[model samples]
Structure formats: structure tokens, C-alpha cells
Target: MPPGDAYDAVIVGGGHNGLVAAAYLARAGRSVLVLERRDQVGGAAVSSRPFPGVDVRLSRYSYLVSLLPPVIVRDLGLRLTLAKRAVSSYTPVVRAGRPTGLLVHRAEPERTRASFARLTGSDREYAAWRRFYGMTGRLARRVFPTLTEPLPTRAALRAEVADGAAWEALVERPLGEAIEAAFADDLVRGVVLTDALIGTFTHAHDPALRQNRCFLYHVIGGGTGDWDVPVGGMGALTDALALAARQAGAYLATGRTATAIATDGSSAEVTYRDAVGEHTAGARQVLVNASPDRLAELLGEPVPRPAAEGAQLKVNMVLRRLPRLRDPAADPREAFAGTFHVAEGYRELDLAHRQAAAGRCPKAPPSEIYCHSLTDPTILGSEAAGQGLHTLTLFGLHTPARLFAADHDAVKAELLSATLARLDAHLAEPIADCLAVDAEGRPCVEAKSPVDLERELWLPGGSIFHGDLVFPWAEEEPGESGPERWGVATGHPNVLLCGAGAVRGGGVSGVAGHNAAMAALGR
Candidate 1:
């Protein structure tokens, strides 16, 4: 806790990735310290009781886990539990003026097959769906393991994948070609495309291929492409990492704002401010667990590149009961268990993107909804659980930060209302009816626009992935530096990026931090 102290390594932020780096470095017998600007660690990967006096702790920012490698969890002895949802997703649609839905079961193939047959009137689309994911599944198993190790070159990864057809379809060409060729149904195609557009604002055929990178990251998680719920909300995962780091003798300080970092390639000095005043800490290396833009500022240099403007709306709500679905055959519990697609038909998605890109909120905003409480009710306290309370999270896509620049508050309110209306269209009962009041007797609902995220969480453009994601592999032959091969390299040898902006970094995964620590130890 002493000012002007020196350590072997100093981390600039105490997010999950920073905590991971601290745990690994300290356990390796390196003197380590983590400085966090926030009072509590975890950054956006945190849980909160947003409602006044509420006992429920919603994973307020990052909701699910998919990209975290099993190796890091084992290496750190993380006390975390990730629960898989039985139903993968349910997309409700209106056909011939009759309401229906398509359900994808996580484990039961027959049920899923039957559901697909019922919706499409044939087994063709279902078979195509399997074959499509089959390609991704093969690639996922081949690629995910290399995340924490030295970054493989593009040629090395492609040669290892060995499936030219898959590599060409998923990696070489735009994702739209695969989506169009694999599925006939519009809604089904849209469901498949959702994975590619979660936090990134791009169409399937984006020439830059940002969507492909997003799709690659989404499907390569855990090698099964399954997005699992963090038991007790996201806070549980970060808390475990914090505990592991502390147990390994890493010093973590909150409310420590790192103002500057100066490194001469072998050693570094970090200047930061706390309540009292500015202080300096010297270290052999500095691992920055913040956006590249933020890191560039601290180093008195121009940003490497702009972090993409995060383009989506995050809404959190507490409901007394699950809202009834319009479809008679679909169970509300099952429908809400996994991702519930809304206003997300293939055409709808494209249309929404066009609307947003043209500088307007979509009249029918595309969004996805899921009830976290259905999979893990432990996030709710005894009173709320006994009272049948549930938490619903809605992620509104194609709602870019640009829309809020004119009038932030007004635009956010309008988008929230439009998004809710879009949800109500698929429900037999209005979502408002199922709302629960917090201790203050106000509706237990809150919404965050891209601007809000930028203000509150410091997300560049409110982009959840921090910026447009780069490929997991190195673009060219890596430099001689150890961190370059690990995808955490910076211009300075003694400084590395260990946050979402790092190559192969994003989501709730600790891969960046682990890679940075490995890079530091090796360097």
C-alpha cells in the first residue's frame, strides 16, 4: 500500500483481465500490483443491484461467458461455475397470420429437429443448419486452444484448420454467402446472423469482414460454441479471479487512476493519483488492461486506432412473472430460458442496419431477450425467488451511438420505447404488466444506450467488445518480441495491452490478461 513503491509488474486496470494477469504473474513469484480506477474491481464484467434496496444482483454489463479458456480457469484454480442452458434459442414468428416459433434445444437433437420441421415444413433447413454449424464446430475445436499461447500466423492457423471449404466460407468470404447457402428460411437465417452482429454494428456482407471476426470469436468459445451463464451472475467470475490474485500475493488497489506510463523497453514508471495526490511506481513491465485509446493517452502517444463505436442498447429489467408468449405451443419458461429473438428476421436485421447507418433509430429495432433468472435463480434473494421474480435482459442491436449524439436523453428514451414495443408485438401480454416494482415502488426497469455505456463504463462508442475485433491469429510473421507473438505487444517492449482491445481479446474471457502475463514472464 505504500506510495512510490516498485514491483516486477504493474497493471493499469483491475478488470477481469487485469486480475487474471495479476494472479498468473504473482503465482509465478513476480512482484505484482493492480491499480483500478473504480472503487470496486471487475469493470464492466460485474453484477449490480440497480434497483433501490433490491436483493437481486443482475449481471449488469457483460451477461454470459463463452470465450474464457478452460486452461486459465484451471491454472488459477478459479472457483467459478458456468451453467449451460437447455434451450439454445427461440425465435417467434408470425406465419400465414398464425403465431409460431422455432426452438433450438442445446442437447436434444430430435426435439430440435422436430421443431425445425414444424416451422419450415421440411427437414431440409434443419439439415443445412447442422451442416453449417458442423463446419464452425470443426474450426472451433481446432482454433480455440491457441488463444493463451503464442499467436499463430494466418497461414499457420489456416493450414492447421485443413478444411479449405470451411476456411473459405467462414474466413475467406463474407458470412452472408454461407448464411444464404445454408438456410432457406428468413427467420432461421437471421438467427444465424445474430451471432455475427451482437455488439458489432455490421451487416453480414460487410466488406471489411468485421462480422466474420465477430462470428469467429462467438463460435470458437469452449470449442462447443455454447454461451453459458455465469453462476451467481458475472460478479462470481471476477470475484473468484480477485480472490485468486490476492491469494497469490498480488496487491490490488482501487480508486487509483493511472495518469501516465513511461517505459524504456526494459523498465517502466507508472504515475497515478488516489485521493491524496499523485504517486509513482516503478516496475520491470506494465500490462495495460484498458482500451488501446486509453493506454495511448497514458503513454502520451496517439491511439493505435480508434476503438469502433459500440453500437447497441442494453436494457435490464426485473419482472414479477415471465411474459406470456403469443405462440400457443411454446412454453414461456422454455422460450425465455435462452436467447429470445425479437424483430430479428433476416430482412428486419438488414433493414434495421440500413436505418441506423443512415442516422436514425430503426422503427422496429432488432433485439434479443433472455431471462437469466430462468437458468440461474440464485441471483435472486429468498424473498424475490419465493415471489416468482425473474430478470430479463434485452440487447437492442443496430442502435448505434450516432443516433444519440443529437440528443442523448431523448433518443435513448425513444429507442427504449420502440424496442419494448417490438418485444410486446411477440407477447400475448404486455411486458409492462409483468414488471416488478423496486423498494421505491417504481418500475424495476432500466435501459442504457450506447452513449450511456460510453459515459458510465468508458466503452469507446459503447462498443461492448471495446472495438471491432481482430482475428485470433497474427496477420503476418510476428516480431521478435515475446508479447508480439502473444498478441499483447505494444510499441514499447516493457508495455503490453492486456484488455479487450488486444488481439484475440473481447467478451468476458481472460485470455488477453493470461497472454500478457505469459508475454511478460517470457520477456
Candidate 2:
């Protein structure tokens, strides 16, 4: 506690990965310190009471989390309750000359196929549709492990390639091409294609693009579906992580912003400026939670260059009401559980990315929406006496928030309006009345929701993922510099990267931080 006192390690961010790294290191008998810029932690996986008596997620950015390893949660003793289904998506189908709309729950493949057959009956190939999913799940389970850590060595890579023949087959084939080759039914193709587009930066039928397949890797990890909510809120995950770190004797400080990292060839020190004064902490090792590029700014031209440009943008809305489906049964508290997807087919999805890429919002922007209140009643259950409230998070692709040319208030209002307008187009009633409050309720909303916030918040390129997963970049060779390779470890001796930008991409996966600790500990 003395001035300039040294610890074994200093973790830069309080996001889950940073906290997890602290817990692992502290438990290993190493002295660790965690510094967070915000008063509270959790990063994107945080929850808050923004509106009066209504608990809403600040970003609620990520809905389902299957890719999170059980070992980390179990080791941390995190009490995570999987929602009924990971996620459920709905696409409205208009019957020709019927003047009626059918909302299809696209999460359940068989049920979706049946529903699709109702419209494209003669063309649905149920068998091939089943085969595609089965094969995809198998392939994802195989390839997913490779992404968790630095790229495997040559021998490891060869073994993985041998073990991943199924994934290779799926990856080699374009999703639409695979569907056409595998199934005779157009409806089956549409459903599979739609699933491929959710949360991805790619078009639905874009051949050779595997972002959806990468997305599937996360979805399958969910165990049952595409999304899951903690018993209380996403913040619970952060709470659990902090609890783990605290239990292990790590020191945590909020409102401590890291300004620069100085390495004297053998050790690293974090320099910070705070309300009281500027200070420095000496440590044998340092772990940074900001993205690789941002870390470069702090450290000045380290290994990894500007990290992978982030591909997607997210918006979180605390809705007054759950989204109304064109039909009521869309609420499959049972059939298909957690998350919801908005866009429908390959062509429609293609147009979305086209607009986003062109710096314009898509006319019918595709969103993956999650209404946590429906699954985890705890959020609403506690405030029964207060106001009826629900929170919905929509993840979409856009030109960065800073690019909006509007001020924060105007941009926030426009985003809220745009999201609500899209929801109204898909549902029955206008959601304006359901609004108990908006993003303005949470101060971090601007920080977490906008890409510009990333740079301002100290994450390079607003990337939550440390880097892109493009090949060769992901290939790990000794002395390589990319995040997919070196990760949180600074080729610079004792320095380490811990946050989402460190490596293994983002999304609450602690691999980069965890591995960096292990490497620093030389375990």
C-alpha cells in the first residue's frame, strides 16, 4: 500500500477477462492489482438500474454465451442459470393473396422447416436440413477450441485439421451452396440461411464467408440455444468475476484510468492520472484489457499493429414492453428459449450489410434482440410494485457511432428512434408508450454503445475483439505479432494483455487474460 509499492501483476481493466486474470493470478499466490476507469465493472456484460425502479442492461450487448468455458465458470464458482433457450428469431412471412402475416420462430429447425413447408411445401427437404445443422454443430465444436488460445503449433494444427474434417467440409462450402447441395426445399434453405446471418457482418448467402459459421461456434457452446441470461442480469457475471478476484485476494480500484505503460526491459509500470494526482505502480507484469491497437497507443508501437477493425455495432434499448410478434405464440418460453433474430432470407440480409458498409443505415436493419425479462423474471419480479418494465438489446452493424455527425443526445435519440421504428415494423403496436426510460438513463450507455466510445474509452478501433480471425493472422508462429498469435503477452518480456482486445477476440471469453497470466507466471 506504500507509494510505488510493487505487485506481481497489474491488470488494466475491470472487464470480466481482467477480473478473471486477477483471480487466477492472486489465487496462485501472486500479488495482483486491478484498476478500472469506471466506478463499477463488467464492461459490456454489465447491468444497471438506469430508469427509476427499472433495471436495464447498459449495453446488454452480448445475449448468449456458449463459448465461455465451463472450467472458468466452475473454477470461479459463477452461478450462471441458462435461460430456457439460447435465442429465438422471428421472420414474418406474407401469404400470397391471404392478406395475413405469419411469424415464424426460426430457432427450431424442424418446427421452422414445418412452418416453411406450409408455404413452400413441395420444396422443403427436411432430411438435408437436419444433416446441415448436425454437421455444422459437429464442425463448430471442433474448430472452436483453436480460437480460444493462440494459434496451435504446426503439429497441433495438423492434428486439429485432421480432427476437423467435418468443419472443413462445412467451411469450404458456401452456406447457400451447402444448403442447395444438401436440401431440395427452398424453405429449409431460407431458414438455414437466416440463421447464418444472425450477429454476423456477412450477407446471408455470401459464399466463402464464415462469420456465421464462427457465430455458430458460440451458439453451440450455449448448450441449447444462442443466448443465455444470468439469474439477475448480465452484471451478475461481472459480480461473480469480481467476487472470484476478491476471494483470491486481488486489490480492485475503480476510477483508476491507466495513462501509459513503461517497461524498463525487465519489469513494467502503469502510469495513471487521477483526481488526487498522477501515480505510478511498479509490477513484474502488466495486463491490459483494451484492444491490441489501443494498447499500442499506451505502450507506443508494440507488436500487434492497429488491431482488427471491428465489424459490428450494437444498440441496447430498455423497452417498456416486450416486442409484440406479428403473432402471439412467438413467445416460446418453451419451444425455443433465449435470443431473437429479425432479418429473414439471404437476399434481404445481403441488402442490410450493403447499406451498413456504404455508411447508411439499412432500410430494414437486421437485429438480434433479447428480452431478458421474459426468460429471467428476476429482473421484473423484484420491481412488481413499481413499474412494468422489460429490457431489449439489439445488436446491429453500422458505420461507427462517432460517424453520425450528430451530438451524443441527438445520436442517442436517433438510434432509439431507429430501433423502435424497426421493431414497430415487425410487431403490432408502437413501443413509444412502453418506454419507461431510454439509454440516457445510463451514463455508460454512450460509452458502451458507440464505436467512437471505444477510441474515447481507450479501446482501439472500438473493437471488442482483440483482432480479426482472418487466416495467416490467426496462424501462430514463434515471435509472431498478431493478437491471434501473441495475444495478451507482449513479446516485450513481462507485459501482458488481458481484456477483450488482448486476444481470442472478445465476448467474455477469458482465454487471452488467462493465458497471459499463465505465461507470465511461467506456469
Candidate 3:
């Protein structure tokens, strides 16, 4: 905590990735110092009771854990539990003026197939779905383990996958073409494409293949692509990481905003500002856990223009009770347990994308809802649990940061209303009627747009992945393959990216953090 004190490594952010790096380095007996601007660590991965007087702790920003490597947990000895959700997803669609839905059961294949058959009127689409995902399952098993290790070349990874058709569909060609070729039903196609568009602003057929990269990260998590709910909320993982880092003799300084970082490739100095004044500390190496643009700013370099824009609306609500579904046969408990798709049909998603691209909110914005309390009631505590209160976190897609540029608050309010209205269509009762009131008698629902996230979390353009995702492996450069490649290295040898902006980074995964630690250790 003293000014001018030196350490083995000084991490410039206290996000989950920074904590991961700190834990690993400190456990290796290297002195580590983690500088955090916020009052605490964990960045977006933290639990909070946003609603006043609500005892329930919600995963405020990042909800689920998918890409966190098991080795990081086991090696750090983190005391965390990620409970799998029973239901995979329940997508409701009106068929022949009757309320119907397609439910993908997590453990029951027969039930999932039956739901698909009922929706599509045959087993053809389900079989195709199985074939497409089965390919990714193989890819996940092959490529996921390499994340924590040194980076591999594109050729090396492609050869590892060993499936030309699967590689071409996911890596070479546009993802939309593959989705069209595989699925017949528009609704079913949309469900598959949702994974490609989470927190990404792009069409399925994007020439840049941004969505393809997003899709790869989504399905390759934990080698199974299953997004599990953190048992005590998202904070549990970060809290354990912080504890491990501290136990290993890392110096964690909160409320310290990193102002500038000056590195001479081998040695570095991190200048940070606290309430008292500015202070500088020397380090053998400096790891940045903020956005890439933010790192550029601290190094007195020009920030990148056309920053990646986050394209999702986050809404958190405490409901007094679960709303009745339009479908009488479907249980509200089951439908709300997994991802509940709202206005996310394949064609509808494309339409929304086009509309948003033209500077207008889609008439029916695509969104998905997750009822976390249904799976983990411990977050509700004894009182909220007894009152039967539940939590619903809605993530609305295709409403980019541009829409809120002119009229930030107005657009946010308008989009929130439209999104909730779309969800209301599938419910027998209005969600408004089920909302829990805060202490001041106000509705407990709160919504955040891209602008809000940028302001609060310092996410450049509100892009959740910190920026556009990159392929996990190193692209084939003319003879550049070595152990020094962790995808976290910067222009300066001592500077490395440990945040979501790293090559193998995105989501709540600690892959980038682990890779940075390994690279720092020269392993």
C-alpha cells in the first residue's frame, strides 16, 4: 500500500481475470499487487441486491459461468459450486393459434425430441440439431483444454478438430449458411443462432465472422458448452479467487484507479490514483485486466476508433411470484428454469438486426430470460424464500449502443417497455402484476442499456466481451509459433492482457487470466 513499493507483478484491474492472475502468481510465490478502481474486486462478476430492501442477492452483471477452466479452480483451490440447470431451454411460439413451446430438456433426450417433433411435426429437425451440436461437442473436447496452455496455430487447431465439414461450417463459411442448411423450422433455427449473437452485434452471415467466433466461445465452455449458475451468485467465484490471492501473499489494493502505465518491455511502473493522491510502483511485469482501449489510454497511446458496441439490454427484476404461462401444459417452474426465448425466432432475429442497423428499435426486440432463484433459492435467503419471491434477469438483444446515443434515457425506457411487452405476450398474466415492490413502494424491476454499462463498468461502447471476440488460436503468421504466445502479450514484453479482450477471452471464463499467469511464468 506504500507509494513507490515494488512487486514481482502489478495487475492494473481487479476484475475476475485480474484476481485469477493474482491468485496464480501469488501461489507461485511471486509478489503480486492488484489495483482496483472500484471499492471491491470482481468487476462485472459480482452479486448485489439492486432492489432496495430485497434480501435476495442477484448476479448483477455476468449471470452464468461457462468458460472457467476446471484446472484454474482445482489449482487455486477455489471453494465454489456451479450448479447445472435441469432444463436447457424453453422457447415458446404460437402454433395454429394455440400456445405451444419447444422445450430442450437437459437430461431427458426423449422429452426434448418429443417437444421438437411436436413443434416441427417430425424428427428430421431434431436429428439435424443433434448432428450440428455433436460436431461442436467434439470440437469442445479437442480445443477447450488448450485454452489454459500456450496458443496453437490455426492449422494445428483445425488438424486437431479433424472434421473438415464441421470446421468449414463453424470456422470457414458464414454461420447462417450452415444454420439454413441444417434446420427447416424458422423457430428452431433462431434458437441455434441465439448462441452466436449473445453480447455480439452482428448478423449470422456477417462477412467478418464475428458471430462465428462468438458461437465458438459459447459452445466450447467447460468442454460441454453448459452455462452453469454460480451457487451463491457470481460473487462466489471472485470471492474465492480474492481469498486465494490474499492467502498466497498478494497485495490487493481497492479504490485505486490506474492512471498510467509506463513499461520499458522488461520492467514497468504502474501509476495509480487513490483518494489521497497519485502513487507509482515498479514491477518486473504489468498485467492489464481492463479493456484494450483503456490499456492504450494508460500507455499514452491513441485509443482504437470504432470500438465494439455491446448489443444487449440487461433487466433485473424481483417478482413476487412466477407468472402463469400461456401454454397450459407447460409448467412455469420448468419454462422459467432455463433460457426462455422471447421474440428470438430466427427470421425475427434477422429482422431485428436490420431494424437496429437502420437506427430504430425493432418492433419486437429479441430477448431471453433466466429465473435464477428457481435453481438457487439460497440467494433469496429465508425471508424472501418464504414469501415465494423469485428473480428474473432478462437480456434483450439487437438494441445496440447507437440507439441510445441521442436519447439515452428515453430510448432505454422505450426499449425496456417493448421488451417486457414481448415477454408478456407468452405469459397468461402480466409480468408487471408479478413484480415485487421495493421499500419505497416502487417496482423492483430495473433496466440497463449499453450506455449505462459503459458508464458504470467502463466497458468500451458497452461491448460485454470488452471488444469483438477473436479466434482462440493464433492465426497462421509466417513462422510465429512458440511458447511465449499466450495471446495475452502486448507490444511491450512485460505488459500483457488478462481481461476479456485477450485472444482466447470472452464471457465469465478465466482462460485469459490463466494464460497470462502461465505466460508470465514462462511455462
Q: Order the candidates by lDDT, highest first.
A: 1, 3, 2
lDDT by residue for model 2 over 385-416, one digit each (tens)?
Answer: 25556666666553344335446455545655
Error of 1 at 292 (Å): 0.7
Is candidate 2 or 3 superior in TM-score? 3
Candidate 1 lDDT by residue in tens digits, 1-523 = 5544989999999999999999999999999989999899998889999999678999998999999999999999999999999999999999999999999998798989999999999999999999999999999999999888798999999999999999999999999999998899999999999999999999999999988999999999999899999999999998999999999999999999999999888889999999999999999999999888888889999876655698888999999999888999999999999999999999999999999999988999999989999999999999999999999999999988888989999998999999999899889999999999988899999998888887877777888877889999987999888888899988899999999999988999999999999999994
Residue 62 lDDT in candidate 1 = 90
| Stronger candidate by lDDT (2 vs 3) | 3
Give each model's whole-structure lDDT: 0.92, 0.59, 0.91
For model 2 the local lDDT of residue 380 reads 57
> Which candidate number has the best lDDT?
1
After TM-score superposition, what is the CA distance of residue 150 in candidate 3 from its true location, in Å? 0.6
| lDDT tens digits by residue: candidate 3, 1-523 | 6534999999989999999999999989898999999998999999998888889899999999999999999999999999999999999999999999999999899999999999989999999989999999999998899898778899998999899998999999999999999999999999999999999989999999998999999999988999999999998888998998999988889999999999887799999999999899999999999999999999999888778799999999999999999988799999999999999999999999999999998899999999999898889978899999999999999999999989899999999999999999999999999999988899999898989999988999999998899989877642232224788867778898899998888788888888898888877
Off by over 4 Å in 1: 2-4, 305-307
Model 2 lDDT, residue 342, Cα: 51
The residue-level lDDT of candidate 3 at 331 comes to: 96
Q: Lowest-scoring 10 consecutive residues by lDDT in candidate 1?
A: 302-311
- The whole-model C-alpha lDDT of candidate 1 against the native structure comes to 0.92
